[model samples]
Target: MAKILVVEDNEDINEILKNLLLGEHQVIQAYSGTEATLLFKQEIFDLVLLDIMLPGKDGGQVLQEIRQSSQVPVLMITAIGDKQSVTQYLLNGANDYITKPFDGDEVKARIQVQLRQTMSQELAGSKRQEYGHIELDSQTFTVSGPLGQVSLRKKEYDIFQLLLDHPKQIFTKEKLYEQIWQDVYLPGDNTLNAHLSNLRKKLKEVDDCHEYIETIWGLGIRLKEWQSS
Candidate 1:
């Protein structure tokens, strides 16, 4: 059963949610945003049912804070969901939005979807990434090949991990900068280029034959597929 945090200010609605999910999952309750955040920090929950309007910290603020640390699935609970509010919530990292006076079946179905997706990602993350003859042990922060194993510095590993995790997904310089460095991308910043150069050098040292990171000219970078015999 999944562990879920239900954050709603109204006692009646909170109890309704708890009762609906009680038999299927473990429900942890919080009546305010501050209380919810505190509970979230203290325990690891599989999913969060968060109300958009709350006392202390709003759901959007709570979600932003949560994104900084964990990628736990969040279903935003809203009483008044305008288009702008929904867009803003999604852009800020909420998995889905549920308007208030919810349907029990709909909430359950959405929760199940998020739970399944999160489980898939967690399972994938537990396995080491392999491309061609190279194995990247994200757990150990090491890349190994027939030549030898090389330890990656934090930034090098972060950059490599991003591409390795997504495989063929091309990431633009700006996206890489924002995701990795958590900073705005400036046109003149050579920081990403420098890191890519260092990362490539390290990879080449381990295995010279394969070119792993592909530069798509003015577009971005992606992991190249290794040819089979």
Candidate 2:
């Protein structure tokens, strides 16, 4: 069952969501945005249902905070149904939004869709994979590229595998550390940087001309555009 956080200031609405989700999933309720923020830091939830009009640190602000360190699926709850508002929410990082007076079935369906997508992504890298000139073998924890094949340490292998799994997606350092280490990512931690450095060096040794990973300064890392060498 997925762990979901329900952030709604309306007592009735919060209780309604809890009742709707209780039997199918684990639900945590927060009455205000501030409470939701604290709860988020304490737990790793599979999805978040957040109300836009919150008591403190409105939903948009909270979303920015979450995006800084995570890519968790967030479904916004908003009373406004204007196209501009919905567009803004999407641009600001909400996976989806439910209008006020929402239909129960639609809410449930949207939640399911987001959860399924998350599960699919998690399972996508569970096999041998390839991208550009690099190939990763899950069974042996080895990577082969144009130049040669090399066995990687567990952490190194995981880092490379994740990059290969989503070559076009930029992974923030926080997201990488949290996923690979299965722990909270502390700011300024050098461990992920060290592993990435080692991983890059190993890849370079195998294929110097092809840049496999590119760091977007002040943002994250993603696979560089492949070039014919």
Per TM-score, the best of the predicted structures is 2
State TM-scores per candidate.
0.58, 0.59
Q: What RMSD value applies to candidate 1?
A: 8.2
Candidate 1, residues 1-229, lDDT tens digits: the string is: 9999999999999999999999899999999999998998788788999998899998988898889767899999998848897888998899998887889999999999999998778767865878888888866678998789998876788998888789889899999989987779999999899989988988998888888899999999988877754
lDDT of candidate 1?
A: 0.89
110-227: candidate 2 lDDT, tens digit per residue: 9999999988886775576777777788766888887898888778987887777787899899898888888899998899989988888888877777888899999999878777
TM-score of 2: 0.59
Candidate 2 positional error at 195, Å: 14
Clashing pairs in 2: none
lDDT of each: 0.89, 0.88
